[model samples]
Target: MERTARIDTAPADAPLPDGLPDLAHLLDGMPGQSRRQDPQARVAPPAAAAEAAPAAQDRLRPVRPWRLLPTRLLPTPRATPFTFAYAVVLAVTSLVATYADPAVVQALQQGSSTDVAHLVRHPVLVLVGSALWIAGGVLSPYTLGFLLVLTALERRVGGLRAAGVFLCGHVLATLATEVPVGVAVATGQLPDTSLHRLDYGISFGVAAGVGALAGLLTPWLRWPLLAWVALIVGQDLLSSYDPLTSWGHAIALTIGIATWPRLRRAVSRTRH
Candidate 1:
């Protein structure tokens, strides 16, 4: 009889022979096969993918230095309403000071001056008027400081609070300095002319804004700013060019510092 070849096949569930490799294991190592089996390899949800797209685009975009300069130098009406409106008023007054007749300018300044005489006669009017005209017009350092500092302060604490801080400094410092002059005049210690001296500007308010803004800044920036202000005011005090005004600046700065505790709490509440 002829010998026939014998054939055997393993069942589907049967284990492979010892010398053979697993076909299933080989298939699982493939890119497509592995992705199907792995949960993390699945595509992200639509919402997540949408969220990531903008961030990726932002990362790839190049920065333009020219575009950033104007934003830094100027205040926007929506973001800093108080500063923008006040700046417009200041600009108008500055133009008036520059173009108006010398006699007219002098008369306006005299009327606006928060001197003891004006304060006593029309406390409300002079106090409000004095702040309208910058002493050295729009080109003054204080005007620039008022723009930058008040804008920054308003951004942090809001327009109303910023206005309050400015007014507090302006009104209080004026009263603090002029009240003493008034007492001296009444006591016969100073000449009557001292009561009517030309004293009108935003310097006191700006000084206070600097002090208040310092409190909100990081310690590194805060201390240096305070030092610089102190140095400038100190030098002015030493020079004795306008001792009363310098003293008023110092007092206004102190008032701003005094508001730090309250300001911090308000800021914390707003954040929460």
Candidate 2:
């Protein structure tokens, strides 16, 4: 008959499977063959303790920097109340100009010089009128209420960039409309004069500015804006070639596309 007895060397303080001998008790007992440590047994580290090292390393590592800083700086961050007020004033003046002496307005609409020029002969009024036109016609009404838009954009991208965007779009639209119409009329394919006295006061004003904004903000929209301008110009050329109806918008768009970069720089400088 043979007998096998094993002694577990567990600590008294440790939770045991049944009551077992502590390390102190085991050390005091016989170092028996049945109590010998197994060679295959591994002293495994605690899972939570093992996981903590990587977590601490991750916390110490540097994070990636943001790449979109330039784009974020494109617009000014603050709102400007003055710009909105300016837009409203321009809108009111534009309506007044249209309503006051509808006959005189007819000439302005025709894009020609006649009695209206005689009436607006005063240099100050002319200056004022021109300013008004820039605000009401060229910027606000014509450019899709971009005068107001420019303010918001300026607060984000800055005023100079906003102004550049407005100017470029307006000027480009104007050129696109004017150039082909003038050529067609000169060639005698179209009438000598049609709606001569009028000008495209607003026409593609807002649309052109929007197009410029699209160009600046989203590159993909640039092609569509350009196509729209081309189509409008082509239609104007095909038709009577009137400046008011088409040429002005063409001109505005041309200027906008060409001068946008310069305007942006100018705005940046001004802010600085």
Candidate 3:
């Protein structure tokens, strides 16, 4: 005969039978119960999430238009020290050229000219001195171009590089144009007086700076600038008022264009 099975009931907090977990222990190990009982049991957010929170907050902050005006008009020393210092020197030289006696100004310009004669006698002195004066003094359009182009370039690639670009165009273009004249003079094809022709100015350097800066600009801006420069230089060439200098401007601009690949790499590295 089969007998009915008998079972014993246990309380909610009672100990378990042999080899089994206690009722209270099983309940306490559940996710919700464990989190409630143990404050340190909470799962932490990911490292990426923690980092993104501040950036999100920053994006929501408002910017003031008025606060940017001063920065746009006058950049900090750290941002454009080379441009500031160079502009100051040019301004002072412009003033001297304007206010000084004609005889003194003529002497200074003659001494500073990067002509074949001065270059032969003191290549270093004249190469540097020639750049100190603007051909048309303070009001020259080249002066404005110099300030704008150089400031923009220096802000991107830095002061040393900007100076190098300017000097590269200045010295190389000067040599390229003047060397031929010197050779012609020596070979008797041109007059000996050609060696002493006045050629002091910052025009070539400004031209090169414009070209280099154009490479760094957006396509819309860059093409217009290049076309404008070409138009101006082309007109000068057609007019033939100073063919040698105009050709130098064209050469210097080409030199700056040749530097585009390197300048792009430099700008990329700076951004990273």
Candidate 4:
């Protein structure tokens, strides 16, 4: 019995551990060794792994449900006829202002002043002209912003109403900003030089149009627009670089928000 026990049991520190199976030896000893898998079967990849990989990828990728994008955001513009005309004027004025000789610049810019004298002396001329004027400087960004915003505006309130918002922003902002200077000039508070300061751009009207159009958007779109516009206005104010420009923007923003009541009615009527 003692001799049999010694033959059956091996020492603990010897080559093979007591309980562990001899897997490598079993594989080598098996028949049809070419077909028998040493690695594939022993360390097979999980069945779930192959299936889960693609599903995991699908879960990670986002899918958009709504198909119609532009048609809804931008239906046909409000004043199709006038919008193009407005664009043409901007293009022409931009060309002439940027490229024309001194004489041409003077001729094109003649009525485009928002100066105190121009507003007071020939309010209609300056107001209307200034709205149409572009410095013909900084073409791409301004033009793109112009096209997107003006087209969106026209789409919302019709051409005529959009025009009204624009004119209101332009004329009102001009008056609001310049009137103080005019008063200061009269009271000898500021030199007449300040009154004649050259201010030429379509930014006031554009800002107003942008504001009014924003009123027409759903909350999702509207909130982002408001945030961006606020950021811009706030930055300009903080910089203290351009008071007149900043004041005009604030007035334009206010005017745009104020038009919400009337514009909402118009939007409701159109929808119905």
Number of the top lDDT candidate: 1
Q: Please give the RMSD of candidate 1 to the true structure.
A: 13.2
- On TM-score, the leading prediction is 1
Off by over 4 Å in 4: 1-79, 136-140
Candidate lDDT values, in order? 0.88, 0.50, 0.86, 0.75
**lDDT per residue as tens, model 2, 217-249:** 555766785786679677886797553545555
Q: Report the C-alpha lDDT of model 4 over 103-215, residue by residue, as the tens digit.
A: 86775566568888888788888777876666446474556666777777777778888778878988898899999888988999999798777787777777887788888
**Judged by lDDT against the true structure, how good is candidate 4?**
0.75
TM-score of 1: 0.80
Task: Single out the weakest 10-residue window by summed lDDT for candidate 3.
Answer: 28-37
* Model 1 CA deviation exceeding 4 Å by range: 1-55, 62-66
Clashes of 1: 0
Tens-place lDDT per residue, model 1, 1-272, is 99997544545446558997665654532344321133335678999989987887776678999998666556679989998999999999999999999999999999999999999999999999999999888889998899889988988898988898999999999999999999999999999999899999999998988999999999999999999999999999999999999999999999888889878888889999
The deviation in Å at residue 64 for candidate 2 is 29
Q: Whole-model lDDT for model 3 versus the true structure?
A: 0.86
Pairs that collide, model 4:
78-154, 78-155
Worst lDDT run of 10 residues, candidate 2, spans 111-120
| Residue 240 displacement (Å), model 1 | 1.1
Model 1's lDDT to the true fold? 0.88
* Model 4 Cα shift for residue 19 (angstroms): 68
Estimated TM-score for each candidate: 0.80, 0.43, 0.75, 0.69
